[model samples]
Target chain A: MSAQGQELQRQGLERPGLQLQAQVARSDFVLDVHIAQPRGRVLAIVGPNGSGKSSLLQVVAGLVSSAQGIVVVDGDTWMNEDTFTSAEKRSVGMVFQDYLLFPHLSVQENISFGLRSRGSSRAHARATTADWLGRFGIAHLAERKPRQLSGGQSQRVALARALVTQPAVLLLDEPLAALDAQTRVSVRAEMRSHLSQFCGVTLLVTHDPIEAMVLADDICVLDQGSVVQCGTVADVTRHPATEYVAKLMGLNLVSGIATAGTVALDSGGQLVTTNSDLTGAVLATLRPSAIAVHRQPPQSSARNAWEGVIRDMEHLGDRVRLDMEARPSVVVDVTSQSVVELGLQPGQQVWLSVKATEIDVFKAHDEA
Target chain B: MTTAATRSPRRSRRSKPPWVLAIPAIIALAFLLIPLAGLLMATPWTSVGELLIDPVTQQALRLSLATSLLAAGCALILGVPLAWVLARVQFPGRPLVRALVLLPLVLPPVVGGTALLTALGRRGIVGAPLESLFGITLPFTPAAVVIAETFVALPFLVLSVEGALRAMDTRYEEAAVTLGASRMRVFWRITVPLMAPAVVAGTTLAWARALGEFGATITFAGNFPGRTQTVPLAVYTLLETNREAAIALSVVLLAVCVLVLVILREQWLRPGALRS
Candidate 1:
């Protein structure tokens, strides 16, 4: 076999991942982020708007000119205090939110741009570009400019362009955020298939919970420019440590001080939680489905109970959600039949109760 | 779309554009075009071809073409880099530097030519050394025609390209940089192509300005037949000796000017002005 064929066969035998530690200071916020994703893994970064998700991605791409950071991808140090590699030399591919396809160039030209920039001959770039255009299922769009493309097609072309370089690290900033709701579902599924086959470390930044949960194997929750929580999707959702993650997971979050099996809610209430590891300040998260409503004081053995008026009610899919005006403004999901039978109405006073074991308490972490 | 299609005609009639603004716009356009009309009226059409073939007229026409193209080339070579520096770089006195760059645009052409003399003439600051060491005197030369043309034409090119550069969506270059393109490659591949319309507009403006250059050329580079006399200088000199020849020459220049204005509106300025 030829030496080139041998070298091609030797690649992808094993792959390394990315390790990022960045301390970037922007005008509105400061990002103190540390994340590690194994090779062949898509780590999703879910954050609220202006929470420094893109800033972190920029730092990893080596685009931020002034930042204290060490970016290592596949055992190669791309940046540090004294030594820094420019974005062009770092072998990082980024997909911006708007796709940012060259409006002037056709699809093939856009994908071949990276290969051409790396000093490849035009014929070789054309061959490689043809392969990518087919892989992304945009072969029919090779001659069409960006304006002629649909939102989904533009996104696919963007992915093909970023992946054509075979970068060691991939940074995708809300890749599907610009798509309409109808297109986002199918495009996200297709993107999941493509991301699964990629061997490089991928950082996916998004504000949509469904996209994050559907695309990534692990989730990194960033809030106010810090990695507030990082864990498996199930771990972070089940025991959320911050209000932002709790909201993303649609769980009721209440912060307070914990003492002797009782946690004092910050908004003028108290809870007898089942948390054995409760300490000084803590945040208690409870699933809305865990709370039971009663017209009168219940004779059951539930630990935490409160009496409040219903502020409002919403009809969720297959269920009714009652927003009670209790301390911390708890939300409870009950059956539609139960709402009708109990005659639930706004401003109706009622007692709400939760079993002690249902509440999960964790240390409260205030944002910097 | 349907509403827009139906409403535009009615809207135009409801408030017949106020005569206050309409009258002035019409007067402004007529004021600019009346001189060309007069030139056309005076042009000796039957004798134009014969008169243009005269040796002096042919020499001036050829020199004008050669020198103007050269001046436009010089402006592009120097002005593009200067425009990039002015548009992208930030340092102290940047505002002052920009004001200085624009000073020549507002300066009188005669004054600019005189200034160029002190700076580059045979006995001038940098020109004296060339005369002593290299035996080169710049005045009354074709090179000086190009120099004077560049002086007046450069500001237009610099201003146009600088505006385009400032208005470019730099994210495209950022995307290229992330795709492993060096800064130079990004500037050439992404930045230049995106700025193509503006560059074309700027180059056309400079070329047209150079082709019609009069005061600066006559002041810096003396009229010496094929050596330095351009169409404008020849026209000015002809008016003193032969009125009919002068009118014919003016007719040629006016035709060229009309062609330039048409091309500017249809090709160079249209796309760049709309997008920018």
Candidate 2:
């Protein structure tokens, strides 16, 4: 390697890897997070609303308040104890949730904004912008203003515009969130393909489970402004450590205190589980599909039973999700045919039965 | 198509509008229009060209245009930055500062003239030092006319541009900065261009106000033909002796006011221009 390459490696930015340790105080919400990723990887942060997902991205991009952090990206120490880089100086690209394309500028100018700002001649910027337009298959929209474009076209333009800067660290905040459901699938595929070609550290913030599962190499679940679980997509889905993560994977999570013989739930209920000699706090999860719905209380082999009114019923194609207001308020998924057989309305009372073996009980805290 | 008035489905079923409201509306319309109608009636139409060609009248008209334009230029240079600061920045006593900027709008022009005299007149605070140091007396000069006009006209420009700056979505500016543009570049390229319609509206308003200025110009910058006497001040002098010439000049000023409103309606005041 050349001397410059070795210096870049020393700064930990040669391969477009990222290391960020930051703490920011925003009104009542304090965000204390440490995130790291090697180059050529995408870290998808899945979180509920108001979970500091966007703020985390903002701090590393040098857009937010005076966050204390050491942000080393692509061999540049953008921020640390002594150095602080403004958003205008740091080569960071972000696609905001709204896209925020300059409404007054044409598609070409929007894409070429970064180049023009970097002091490129108008002719060079225009040529590079046109190249990106062609690459993104949006050359036909080169002259059209943002308002003249459709939602899908605007999203494509936003993506192309971000990549035109050739940023070392790419940040996407809910990139697919603005599209209608029909456009999301096709756009997601296109976005995934484009992201795969980029040799950089990409941090994607999304609330949708499918978006995280499909696009991310690893998943980092954030709750209340802290990372609750970080692992491969399959691992986090299979053994979620938090209730929020369980809900994302379409499972009913029940938190309980495990004694010698039984597990006592916080919502005034007890359950018998197959796991032996578990103590202190534990989280037990049941697949929504595994719970059986009955009109009357059943005396079957199932070890747990609860009678509750249906709080909400969401029709999910062939299945219906019953948000039942039982002792612990569990989500039960039943087939649409069974929903009709049981004549389930939101106010109708029903019995829920779950076998002991079906519940997966794990220690609630990773430290514990 | 949606904005073109659809026939009111409910109007046909309702009774006629009350005479109580109708009478006052007619009175209000006539009250404002009758003076204009009388002015048109009084204009000496026959030798109007010869009257306009008269050297004194021409000079006052030229002086009026010159002073107002210069005042508008000064106001533009100063008011734009003030408006930007007022709209975009947070500071202590902002409300008080804004109120002080708008004081001239509510103060009678004569009172504003008196205030200007105490501040800029030869015997006054800054005026004494200026006169002693530079040997330059500002009163009874064209520069004084512009000073008076700018003093009274700045509020209009500042208010309009500030409202425009506040209404614009600041996200575009943030995006520009994120794209590596400096704050100055973003302001020039993004903020100023977005403020175009409002700035034009404000400039026209200030120009009209300056051209019609009588009290302040006459008091601070004494009325002198071909110098400080604008059209309104010239008309005031003519009212004492030459009624016909005064009427002609009044007609001229009225025509310019109408012309300005017509041009304003076509450009900045149009519904379409304000939408963006």
DockQ of each: 0.62, 0.47
Q: Give stretches of model 1 more than 4 Å off.
A: A1-15, A119-121, A251-368, B1-15, B266-268, B271-276
Backbone clashes in each candidate structure, one number apiece?
Answer: 0, 2
| Candidate 1 lDDT for residue A9 | 26
Q: Candidate 1, TM-score vs. the true structure? A: 0.77
Residues B1-276 of candidate 1 have per-residue lDDT tens digits of: 999999998898777988988899999999988988888888899999899999999999999999999999999999999988988999899888888877778999889889888888988998999899999999879999999999999988888888888888788999999988988889888999887877887888899999989888888998898899999999989899877888898888777877877867854555556232
Fraction of true contacts retained by every candidate, in order, equals: 0.79, 0.57
Report, for every candidate in turn, its global Cα lDDT versus the true structure: 0.84, 0.82
| lDDT value, residue B261 of candidate 1 | 78
lDDT of 2: 0.82
Task: Looking at model 1, give its docking quality level.
Answer: medium
* Model 1, CA-based lDDT: 0.84
Report the lDDT of model 1 for residue A196: 89
Query: What C-alpha lDDT, on a 0 to 100 scale, does residue A303 get in candidate 1?
Result: 89
**Stretches of candidate 2 above 4 Å error?**
A1-16, A251-368, B1-23, B262-276
